[model samples]
Target: MAWPTGASPYGIGVRDAVVRGVGPRSTDGVIRVWYPAHVPSSLAARRYFDGPDELQIMTRGLGWLLSARGVRALGGWRTRGHTNAPPAAGRLPVVFFSHGFTGFVGQNTHLCERLAAAGYLVISIAYPEAAASICAPDGSSNVMSAAQRRRLVGDQFARAMVRLLRARSIDAENRAISEVTAVDTLARENDRWSVHLTAMLDALVPIDQRRARVDTATAAILDAGDWSRVALMGMSFGGSTSANVAHLDERARAAINLDGMQQGDILLGQDIRVPLLVMSSAGSMLPSGRVVNDLHYESRRTATGRVQRVLVADAGHYAFSDLVAFGARRTRGLLDLGTVDPERMLTLVADTVTAFLGDALEPGGDSGTDETEVSP
Candidate 1:
């Protein structure tokens, strides 16, 4: 439950808002936004898991003793952001974050805090339907979707999808994946999340009065964001969401997917022209023992865009998330976190992502920060 001590100078501020999506395919959405802010020394930082619903989601309904212990540990941890603090001066770049499937909004709070400290407005979107659980300020928790819950616990549909992910080649993967109509469910879900991402963008549009209402704090924070310089980033299924949103939204100058297997129509010949950096752990292997970049390889081969790939050494699937820093100590066997030091992994990930986004969104690029650098 430890948080990363980031190097940025700006104090962080966070606020949450629920907005109804204006898109025909969109749904009501919850977003937690972190931004650079002015904080007084006397301000008290908020708890990591602040309320009942968040605590329930984090502890998985407090079903296991280990989980309860983890929650107790988390209770002592504090976030870097002050709730609804004054926004820092100057319009900053915007970056949207999506969480993995079955993950709640704050799953990657460490990364979001790091980005917010680095002077970007970071909006972490919550997909209540697909998330393990998401508690809104209104005291309602949207639990996991029954269909997605079945998929997670290994129904026939889930097994078939896993088999497709292990296919030896793109053609083989695509051919097999096409036979399953249920794959459309992923496409539909991706569309929903992507639409939610765009809806957040719509909220920032100064003239979009027809969209959801923005509160005073939300308005001030959104106003400080330079929407023209926007990027998308996420972990796990959230990573897949980032890639798909970048492909569909022309405003996305760059995207980073942290170790998620690709899903959605992005695998079915849709070209992504945005600059994308796909970071992988050392362990994404196919059935034939070849360690592949999965969608990264396919995007590099056919997509007319700047695509860079990096594989972190001694890392596992969950290493890109905050789960590595906290729950890994107790749930290591279940979560399969990488062997790298949690703090070091968090620093490496934050540095790499910050460097990439700085170069992609800022003028003249981020001087000499090595976007490809990784720690041993």
Candidate 2:
């Protein structure tokens, strides 16, 4: 596997730890932090997951087809970051990241590393129940159970997708989106995830009482984070969660969604209070100049803060993920990794996101809707 290129003035340091559960409904989950650090010359880059954990996660679902040898080979991949290196001093802006459904915390470590190198504190959260594979601080591993998969994608989901894709009119499309959001099981699950994200934000912000729950090292890192200037970002279902959390949480300064359709409250008439940047894969939009699988239509109907939409040409849904670089050519082709060169795709996404965050986090604030297309 190839390491994704990142441009940064600061050396990156990463740490894996558990974030104590907040509130009555929340449960402990694994979290990895990538931040500017004082890496010594003698330190070495760390393996992707450092052990067999990667194989356990990668060898499920369609990934079951991957040979154990191939999966082990992937484990040999190294990250640019060193483990638990000394964090750089000073308060830095923070970005909270959530992974896609069935995705682990490391799904987009390249992006987290890039953001960290650029001098931000990046925290990636992993939900044990929702993730394909995740490990707690004590070394217990959790993989999504078979029953969980069936419940997540069973009959209710199939019917929703069919109605969502077949809607011919704007009203019909909105109606279909509403029905999908109304599904009790799915909606409850989305709410639970959103609460999980909120709990993370609560742990970071100094004013929140939950800060005491984090470990000493993590608390020190949090102490150096400018939580007042926070951003929420994620991919797929995680992206949708970011939008929802940003809408409800006044602490979030901005939100970014990578190739995910907005659902739940976001599609049901709630407006995101903070700025939102929705980066879509080429397939999400039609040549007719409309986004079919996203809240592009719904967002236009509901007034909100600045919303910028970017359509990446020659890209597929998974292009926004590390799979574009990690998977073999044949594997990528089978997974719809699109025609965009993997390196170029990473560069494009990182640069675009960094630029957007810079503007969105500016003091005075920004508003309005802007849509553009980029070919990498």
Report every candidate's CA lDDT.
0.70, 0.75
Compose the digit string of candidate 2's lDDT tens values, residues 1-376. 5566665667889888776655332225578899999999998988876756545655552244346665566567787888888999977888989888777787787888888888888989986577766766666666677677566676787787678777777777767767777777778779889988987776667544435667788777767788778999999889889988887888999888998776675645445577888888877763334675455323454465478778987899888987777567787777778989988888888887887887887786663577778875
The numbered model that scores best in lDDT is 2
Per-prediction TM-score: 0.84, 0.90
lDDT of 1 by residue, 318-340 (tens): 77877677664557656777677
Task: List CA RMSD, all candidates.
Answer: 3.9, 2.9
lDDT of 1: 0.70
